[model samples]
Target: VVKYGKWLVAAGAVGMNVLAARDHNRAEDVFGALEARCSDDPRLCDLGDGGAYLDPGTEALYQQSVGYDRRARRWLIGGETALLGAAAMFVWELTRKTHRPDNIPFEPEVRSLRNATGVGLRLSF
Candidate 1:
């Protein structure tokens, strides 16, 4: 998860998905999925033909995500708040570097708790 966050930060800083994902595995996963689908026998399922569509879509989406990550770096969390948090973390780390204290970034907190409420949607036949 921390690795993902770091990747997102790089993407945000670089401001280009094609450039950012140049070092990311998301594109590899896209290609692997497309390859698997293309290689599958038609008797089993029809997959190869639509894969081209997915490729462009995946590229577009990855590019967009890169842009999003880049923009996230500009998040204006109150400087005072962030400074206080960083200060607290510095002191806390003095005690235990790996200790999880509280209010960790990206972990669910008050406002984000709304997102933790309703489950994600899924489709099933």
Candidate 2:
């Protein structure tokens, strides 16, 4: 059960990371577009009081870029959390003790015959 939980957590981490990567890519694309627009229109680059006043179209693009950037950050945080969960599960598994039936013991034997010689393991329950 712990093994399965570890696998599930690992898979979730991978999935979250994939989503984060996708969102990050989208954010980069939007940022590029925003830069291009600012370059084409010097007025869009003007910043007063720490914020530039933008036209409706430019404002829409800026909002879109902000949204993507925010989403990417959220996905990245989720991915990191999932990764930590997976690591914890791995540590738990490593620290766990193996349980075997007390009545069963491993017995190793050496066998010899006219034409063959081999080693065998015997277990009795």
Candidate 3:
């Protein structure tokens, strides 16, 4: 089985990185504020370093808002677990060659019970 492949990874990355939804933006504004404060005289920017910056470079507040979302998405697919599963698949062999290598092989015990004829749907949060 091809588990936790491209579809899961891309969906997770795109949704979390862009964060184009309205509700998430509103929540960010409620919890976080823009660095728009120019404390010294309204003409100078308060760089949060106790020093007044004459012309602080412009940076979008939305950039900061997406930082944690990116982390959350990268971890959504359980990458480490998938890595371990792949390692285990390549590490073990279920069918040993007792007869000629070209002889018909029986299905592995685990797969015989775990799989079915109909389509199977998988979903996770």
Number of the predicted model whose TM-score against the real structure is largest: 2
TM-score, predicted candidate 2 vs. hidden true structure: 0.73
Clashing pairs in 1: 12-70
TM-score of each: 0.21, 0.73, 0.26
Sort by lDDT, best first: what order?
Answer: 2, 1, 3
Over the stretch 6-125, how does candidate 3's per-residue lDDT look in tens digits?
A: 345445445544443443555366335544343334554434564434444312433444664455445544454444555554444333234545443443332334556444444333
Q: Which of the numbered candidates is closest to the native, going by highest lDDT? A: 2
TM-score leaderboard ranking: 2, 3, 1
Cα lDDT listed for each candidate:
0.45, 0.81, 0.45
Clashing pairs in 2: none
What's the true lDDT of residue 102 in model 1?
60
The lDDT, on a scale of 0 to 1, for candidate 2 is: 0.81
Candidate 3: residue 80 lDDT (0-100)? 49
